[model samples]
Target: MTAPASSAPPLPDPAPYQGAPERHPRRPRHPLDTATDPEAVELTAPVFGPADVDALDADLTRQHSGEPLGERLTVTGRVLDRAGRPVRGQLVEIWQANASGRYAHRRDRNPAPLDPHFTGVGRCLTDGDGRYAFTTVKPGAYPLPGAGAWRPAHIHFSFFGTALTQRLVTQMYFPGDPLLPYDPVLAAVPDPAARRRLIAAYDHQLSLAGGALGYRWDVVLGGPAATWAEEGRR
Candidate 1:
């Protein structure tokens, strides 16, 4: 005799196989594992209008009634991206010690005389061609607190995009500075080529008639030849 099929609602469709739970859930990875990584964290751009920056802000020497004590300098440069394209309309700021190697800050106990007329700070926006210039004095080398070696004569540069988080800080050194060899901060950069990029070149074309000496330094935001940032690559 043939056996009849059991009904039992067709065995409940085999209970839809449930796979095992992930033994080790994969950890999230950062966008920038390496410099070449294509992924990047998007940052909001800062908003700045013409009224935000005063025309006089670009001239540090004229901030006070009298001129600051130091060798007058006309520092000019273009801000560029990795592709060598101009980064127009960005804000560039600079602050440094006076010619005597003394900072205007209260905590700076370098013992050097401070120039009453010099505030040692300036800022300007990049032009359409990405060029920005400042009229100021060359900063003097200052000794690091408790450290035997002295810091090289360099101007502290701060570049800002749309936001404060987009700010990139670095120091610009003059060419042929003897202190360059001993500056621990500059030495922290492992690459020789990258260190050289920090030094500005003398530009006679940009020099003032008999006033400030001119220097040209172009900042590269990223790429193989990008400028060496103080905090590291951004």
Candidate 2:
């Protein structure tokens, strides 16, 4: 005879069948969605004028009483949008290690000498043609603390749009830095062409007759050819 249904209580009817637990379709991601993008965050714009920056601010070498040591360089570049339009009146800023490859910050333990004459910081507003220039010394390469690697000579650049949040940051490397291949920071950029974009081109025309060597690096804000930003991929 068929055994009486086993004494185990009927599986509590699956708690009244909560019908497939309400599935909501995920919203499609927009190609241009910046909601979660840190680089797209909106920031308050501060009012700035010519008086805000001293005329001497663009010249890093003359910041101090005497000239800094090392090879003086004249770096000039244009800031453009993806469409190749000038980003006029935008603020362009740069800071880098001194000729000895040592930062002015106290935390830098690179054991390299610091330049009292060179603060390694400069800023200028882009002209109507989106050009910005700086006169600084060539930064030396320095070894990373624990990475067993060295950083090539490079200048850190910051571009400020209408709002502080609209800033984009990149580095300008010398045309021929052997250390570029080993630098983890530069290597992080997977694309070779994009990597090359970070290297400034030598420009003899911009070089001073008896003074600074010249390098030109054009910054493309957003596009297929956009300069690679340090914070994130564009």
Give the top-scoring candidate (TM-score). 2
Report the C-alpha lDDT of model 1 over 1-234, residue by residue, as the tens digit.
Answer: 999864432212222112212322356543444356433333344567778988789999889998788888998889999999999989998999999999899988999999999989989899999999998998998888766778889998999987655788888999978777777777766777888899999988767553679999999998899987855313
Error (Å) of candidate 2 at residue 34 is 17
Lowest-lDDT window of 10 residues in candidate 1? 11-20
Q: Give per-residue CA lDDT, model 2, range 102-192, as digits (tens).
A: 9999989999987888888899998899998888899999988766778889998988878765878888899866676667777666677
The TM-score measured for candidate 1 stands at 0.78
Report model 2's TM-score to 2 decimal places: 0.79
lDDT for 60 in candidate 2 is 88
The ten-residue window of minimal lDDT in model 2 covers 11-20
TM-score of each: 0.78, 0.79
Return the lDDT, model 1, position 20. 14
What C-alpha lDDT values do all the predictions have? 0.81, 0.80
| Pairs of colliding residues, candidate 2 | none
